[model samples]
Structures are given as structure tokens and as C-alpha cells.
Target: MSTLANETYEARVVAASEPGVTFSGALSSEWIKFRTLRSSWAVLLAAVVALVAIAGLIGYVTGSKWDGQLDPEDRVASAPLQGLFLAQLLIGVLGVLFVSGEYTTGMIRSTLAAVPRRLPVLWAKGVVYGLVTLSTLIPTTFLAYGVAQLFLSHFGHSTSLSAPTAFRAVLATGIYLALVGLLGSALGWIVRSTPGGISLLVGLLLIVPVLLEVVPGQWAKDISHYLPSAAGASFYSSLQADGALSPGAGLLVLVIWVAVATTVAAFLLKRRDG
Candidate 1:
């Protein structure tokens, strides 16, 4: 009886000594997985390069058009941001892979086995990758802005970052991309396939806008401005796009879009298999 009691106490101590699962641990795990993946870093680098490179190219062309003549008021609308459409494609796809790639490699089963509750894994992926996306994209956006303005400065056509519209356009562009990255991550949870998520993202951002333009109705015209792409664009530069919402309204619309996508994904995640 004494031996049995000693063994029981030993087993209890061992069990207590083992660490239990926690949300913070899950977050750390997801971060490690993200940083270790070559594709994640590669996509991030590609986004940085694409945005900065394209902005510089557009800036050079815009400046060169004036043949070295200065025009203080002839500035283009957010020329530094011209490259973000392409960056969106790259970053959005990476967000999709944040979830889908695990399933493809069968690692999700193990992840689920560890975090049986499941939704925390989904939330962690979005939060970690979203934060990573925001941190990287914001600085990169500013860098691209400076690079573009350098080219514009050569022709004395550069707009000041302190200018009211210029600050909003640049900062809003960064936030817009961060939300787009979240949108892509949410799509990954909903579809659970990288290709499918990518297709949906492209359809929503690129194809829908084109289709809306041809629908030939006031409703379509108004609704198009609320879609993720146009809404995000308006948040940065309502002055540039026709039928754009005010910056505040456009940002609100975009937040709704992202929130809805994530909620749908969460509902499906709770109901479906890993």
C-alpha cells in the first residue's frame, strides 16, 4: 500500500512538471514556423523589391516627362504607391500559404493534434503573419516613398511628405496592404487550399473591379467602390479614384470586409476538419 501511494504521488508530480499548451506557446510556434520557411522570407523580399522598384520606375518616368523642368503643382497622385498592386499579389499569396501550406505538407494534422482546440492556431497564424506583414510593409512603403521622391526631386516635382494628402496616402497605403495580407490569411482558413485561396484573392481584387466597371448600373458603380481593392484605394487617395469614399469611410468599409472574411473563416474552421 505504501509503494502504491508513492507511485501515485510520483505520477502526479511528473504530470504537473510537464508544461501544458498555451496561446503564447502557440504564437511562438507559429512565429518559428513562419520565420523558418524560405517561401515566407522570399515573398517578403519580393514584395519589398516589387513595390520599391516599381515606384522608382514610375517616379523616373514621371520626372523625365517634364524634361528636367520643375512644376510644383504638377505632381502625380501618390506616385510612390503605384507598385502596391503587384506587392499585394505576392503578400496575399503568402498569407494564403500561411494556412494552406501546412495542409499540403500534412503538418496541419500534427499542429491540430497539439492544439486540439484548433481555432487558436488559426488566430495565431493571422495575428503573427499580420503583424509581420504590417511591420515589414510599413517601413518598406516609406522606403519606396523616399526612393520615388528622390527621382521626383531630380525634376523638382516631388511632393512633401508633410503635405496633408501625401502623408495620408503613404501611411494609408501601408495599412491597406496590411489588411490585404489579413484578408489573404483569412481566405486561407476558409478554402484550405493555396491555389484556391490565391484564385479567390485575385478574383476579388483584380477581376471584380473590371467586371464592376462593365456592369452598367449606378448600383454596381457605387458598390465597386466598397470592394476591398477600391475601398482600400479610396482610403489612401479618394482624390484620385472616381466615386471613391472619403478616407475615413473607405477605411471603415475595408475593415468590415476583412472582419467578415475572418468571421466566415473562423466559423468554417470550427466546423470543418483540419
Candidate 2:
């Protein structure tokens, strides 16, 4: 046999031996694969930039409109959450792209080949994606908040992260981004089509829900609160709503969604032909 064939044979033998391999080892290999890819870093950086720019622009425009009637407190409370509506979209897209892009580029095949047990691969991807997104989101959000505060401070509407609501918003922003990323990755794994996964995510986040809201009924408003984006949005509210859930309830909604998606994805990954 040729030398290349001999090497391939040897590698296959070593992989087949696999007696000493552990979950941690598998996860580490997956992490290496994830971080070594250039697209991962690029997309993450782009998300941060997009979120910051959009938030800052909104701040600047609103600061310009601050006729000084709505006291600093009111202005700060009202405007800071504006950017999040768009920021979540960017984060959600990035999250979906993380998994779906692999399938689009035919990288999923190589990824699965390296780790023949597919579930571990998915789990590792979730861990890495979750941590990376959380890290980026926390800092990006605080930075956005600081930038917004700078604009607000100019108009005597400054806010600090130390405040109870501001602190919760900062933490919730990171947590919300992480959950969205997890949900996107799960859906991407199941759908395995970039456009399809993204469309599903966008539909859940913006499209189907918006149409439901426009129907002009109280039931729609009540049901809308249970949707992923709407439930997640509750965490950012400076003042808790009268009938709406507490922050913990909002987080529980996010958790349930992520759990359901991941479970379904896991089932599909194990049973379906890759």
C-alpha cells in the first residue's frame, strides 16, 4: 500500500482503540476546532460592533430630542432599552449562523468525522459558544451602557450600572444573549440550513409574533408575553410590569425554550442521517 494509505489506516486503528478517551478530552478537541475557525471570531466581533453602533446611535438621537422635560431618570430609563430590540436580532443571527454556517460550508461533516459521537460535539459547541457569547455580551452591553450614559450625562440623564435596575439589565443582557445563542445553535443543528435556521429564528423573534400582536386582541398580548423574545424582554424592564412576570420568570421562559430546542436537536442528531 502507499504511505498515505498506511497513515490513514494507522489513524483509523488509533481512533478505533479509543479506550482511554473521556468526555473532557472530546470537549477539548471540539473547543480547538471551534476557536481555530476564523469565522467564529469574525462573526462575534461583528455582532459586538453592530450592537454598540446601533445602541450609541439611538442614544445620540434620543439625547438630541431630550427637551429637558422628561427628567434625567425618565430619559435614562426609556432610551437604554431601545437598542436591545435590534441588538437581540444581531445576536440571534450570529448564534444561528454559528451552527448553520458549518452545514452551509460543509464543515459539519468534517466536524462529525473528528468526533464520531455527535452529541458530545453538539454539547461542546454549546459550552464554547455559550461562554464566548456571554463574555462578549457582558462587556459589549456595559460598554454600550457607558456610551449611552455619556450621551445622557450631557443632558443630565446619566445612569449607572450600580443602580438596581441598571445592574439587572447588564446581567440580564448577557444571560439573554447566551440563551438566544444556545437556542439558535440547537435550531441550526436540527435544521442544518443557514437560511432555514435563520428564518426560523427571525420568525420566532420578530415575524410570527409581530403578526399575532397586530391582530388587536387581549389574548394576543397575553400570549405574546410568553414568546421567547417577549419573555426575554421582560428582564430588561427597569420597573417590573403589573401582571408581567418577575425577572426570574422571564429567565425561566428563556430556559424552557433553550431546553426544548436542545432536546429536540439532540433527538434529531442521534436518529437522522447526517
Q: Pick the lDDT winner.
A: 1
Relative to the true structure, how large is the alpha-carbon lDDT of every model?
0.86, 0.77
Q: Which lDDT tens digits does candidate 2 get at residues 1-274?
A: 6746636564454445556546787678767866887877876777777667766776776677778455454464534645566666666776777788878888888877766778987887788888888888888878877887787678675767776678888678777877888888988988999888888988898897789779897988888788888778777667665566678888898899999999999999988877
- Give TM per candidate: 0.91, 0.85
Query: Residue 33, candidate 2: how far off, in angstroms?
Result: 3.0
Residue 179 of model 1, lDDT score: 90
Off by over 4 Å in 2: 1-20, 68-78
lDDT of 1 at 35: 99
lDDT of 1 at 57: 89
Per-residue lDDT of model 1, residues 112-193, tens digit only: 9999898898889888988898899989888898998899889887777887688888888888888998899899888888
| 77: Cα error in model 2, Å | 3.9
Clash-forming residue pairs, model 1: none
